[model samples]
Target chain A: MARILVTDDSTFIRRRTCTILNRTGHEIIEATNGNHCLEIMQQDKPDLLFLDLVMPGLDGFGVLKTLQDAGNTIPVIVLTADIQDAVRDECMQLGAHTFLNKPPAEAAVLAALTDALAEGERKA
Target chain B: MTSAAHSSSTRQLNVLQKDAITELMNIGVGHAASTLHTLIGHKIELVVPEVSLITLDDYHQLQPYEADELLSTIWMGFRGGFEGNTSLIFPTDSANTLITALTGEMDDSPELDELRAGTLAEVGNILLNGVMGSIANMLNAALSYTVPEYMECSLLNIFRKNHTGNDTIMLARTTFAINELKVEGNILLFFKVASFEQLLISIDRELAI
Candidate 1:
């Protein structure tokens, strides 16, 4: 089981994701938006991050950039309801371990976490 | 600006427009409910006939409570000669409840929640856009859509900014048999007067031409 941080501006989404991860036997933490996510990230690093792209202030893209700049290599999963493919691809290219569509499949979420964990193993 | 031509063109929910719009949304949302039924493998009971229009003013008067005030919303901006925004909101409780159904699991699992939210967002996207896009296609007018913006908050507060203004809204209520989750809320459709008029014209032209 892994301690995973789930970040999105939506409460429904955060709770929903937390529920999913909890069932998977991983511990979960939640944040509302990108800024809150950063505050939490600075304090406790989770096994993985699930992020939403468009938000009120600092969005997921900005959050990913900040983490990357801070030299944080935690695998990030980008979630979006928008139609910005180019932006999503860039996030993946920029170090997002994987990108999945909004309302991901259970298989996809597990796969993403596994991939992120494996990447962490390689880096370690 | 609410000019004569603009005011005249921006008609309220006359019986026809109201019913037609509502009916179209019914077709759209009915389709969405169908998608949910298939995706989650649950029997969902929904009524498109319940769709209606409300101004931002009436929206506030209908003041709703945020069960888990911490917010989560799926949003998409739509524009063309017409412009609008469609949002699918799942409060915390609703999210958990729906997740339970979609996963076919009785317990609340964190990973399932995440997947559920993502699934809801996709489902919302498919539902909202499915209806809206189909409407646009019927009119043969072009609309550009931005990816959905996922958000959270005191939903009541989200609409406080322009509550006095006239805004078209579509509220969707969905109930799934498996989890017995009752998800009901409004989908706000905001647009400038001109854009709305353009949308009407598109519809009219689609009907006539």
Candidate 2:
């Protein structure tokens, strides 16, 4: 099982997402917002991240840009409730492994986890 | 009344200001829809078709509902580069429809009645924060939101509570819908007069960038 970090401002959303991922046997870490997520990343170095886009300080875009600039290669799966093709394209350009709508389905979550881990293994 | 007149005199938002507010709201609504998707397990869509600077009085004239119409309202306050109130307003039926769609259950249960208030608060909390957070980010400002409160009241009472003399509300007329469920609701953003001026300055700065 891979180490995954879930980041969002809402306590309810964070816990629900963690519960979903827990059933898949993955270890889950929680961050309240973007700044917290970044701090945790440095210490824990999780294999993948599930990030919320609209947060108080340092949104998901800010976090993604920072990671790219620092040459960090940890896979990021943007899980946001934001709309449009433009945002998806922008996240991919910034090196997000994939984008999924918030409250993703159990199957979709599992599939994304598999794909991200497989790709990480390939890179290694 | 004097403050309202004063605010009205300078209420016109320039092209740059309007665009900035529109873009910020567009980003915010998108995030709100994403949160809704998680609750319902279905993709949701919200669109802000118009962002206009209008005084509360002018808005009253254009409002679609009667003064006594029941509204499902969630209100919250935000402070950052500026301070203001944001709300999710829906006709009672629309709110019930949305709750039903999200929970996939009828509203007949007594438990459902209690859940209704909490459910709407959660929904509004996600949506309002999304909008304000986007606007703050675009302006490079830090915004913290108050805990959301849910209320069932007449449209007029809702407006009265939000209005304080001459507040220049940023009326971002929004349509939130889930195409699958055919449920739709409306949202509004209200920025107080002084808070709005600060926003305009921030928007101008963003435009310069």
Could you say which candidate leads in TM-score? 2
True contacts kept of 1: 0.02
The 10 consecutive residues of candidate 1 chain A with the worst lDDT sum are A80-89
Which 10-residue span in candidate 2 chain B carries the lowest summed lDDT?
B1-10
Q: What class would a CAPRI assessor give candidate 1's docking?
A: incorrect
Per-residue lDDT of model 1, residues A47-89, tens digit only: 7888987666788878988988888777888865443345556
Best candidate (score: lDDT): 2
Colliding pairs, model 2: A81-B34, A82-B30
lDDT of 2 by residue, A3-65 (tens): 999998765567667878999888899997899999999999899999987677888899999
Cα displacement (Å) at residue B13, model 1? 17
Where does model 2 sit among the CAPRI classes?
Answer: incorrect
Give the best candidate by DockQ: 2
- Tens-place lDDT digits, model 2, residues B45-66: 7654476656556645435777
Off by over 4 Å in 2: A1-124, B1-9, B41-48
**After TM-score superposition, what is the CA distance of residue B12 in candidate 2 from its true location, in Å?**
1.6
Chain A TM-scores for all candidates read: 0.91, 0.95
